[model samples]
Target: MSGSFSLFIVGWGIIMIVLLAIGGFFMFRKFLKRLPKEDGKSILDWEEHYLELTRHMWGEDEKQFLEELVSPVPELFRDIARQKIASKIGEVALNKKQKQITRDTIIEGYIIATPKRDHKFLIKTLKEKNIDLRPYQSLFEQA
Candidate 1:
């Protein structure tokens, strides 16, 4: 009877361990989904490679466009803009063209949603995202 009881206890322990492992596996998967991933290449990986290049190419004074457009309320505008970018980036950030489209959409939304813009941060972020502004000169000028 005692041997049977011990076996039952071990069996229960094994089941509990298996259940815990399964739960942990699912939780880890959920956590991983929140981070950027591109077939093992992540946004972080891209930024790590490009940050230096961008810093060397763009100057602090290059924010003239965003400064004028988002000058009124910077914090709020940035938060909203980042949210927009975050949402779109997940779908389109795998390639340069798609990433550019995501950046453009986020900036366009920023222009529309900004109560008052913070050109400094806006331009900084645009540079961070490597946005190409050649086609949007008119939009920038309007701000």
Candidate 2:
């Protein structure tokens, strides 16, 4: 009876260990799956690509739009200004007059326009300000 009881206890312990090991393996696999897949690209590279893509798609007007949306405090305004300028240049239209007007309106809208409730207002304001938007330019350009 003592021998049988010891064998039973040993078998139960082994079973428990096996079950725990299986559970741990599954948990580890799940954790790996939750982690972001690395394409061997550095974060800075990804950021540059994202910025370039955004610049290609939205241009300067979008930068100004982001500034208005964020309303950086005085300390951060210079960085915002640089971004605004860069984005503007990135999206400048072919017609100089139209581009200037669009730039001016974006600035004016940021300063004077009421807090917009919808994103469409930004696009509408750009159009109303007579800015020509070429959204597809980035897609067509060869990287």
- Over the stretch 60-86, how does candidate 2's per-residue lDDT look in tens digits? 656556455444335634464344433
The alpha-carbon deviation from the true structure for residue 73 of candidate 1, after best TM-score superposition, in angstroms, is 10
Which portions of model 2 miss their true places by more than 4 Å?
39-143
Per-candidate TM equals 0.28, 0.27
Candidate 1: give the clashing pairs.
66-119, 67-119, 70-117, 70-118, 71-117, 72-116, 72-117, 73-116
lDDT score, candidate 2, position 50: 37
| Candidate 1 per-residue C-alpha lDDT over 90-133 given as tens digits, one digit per residue, 9 for 90 to 100 | 33233334323233544664543333355556556566667776
TM-score of 1: 0.28
Model 2 alpha-carbon miss at residue 48, Å: 25
**Top lDDT prediction, candidate number:** 1
**Candidate 2, backbone clash total:** 2
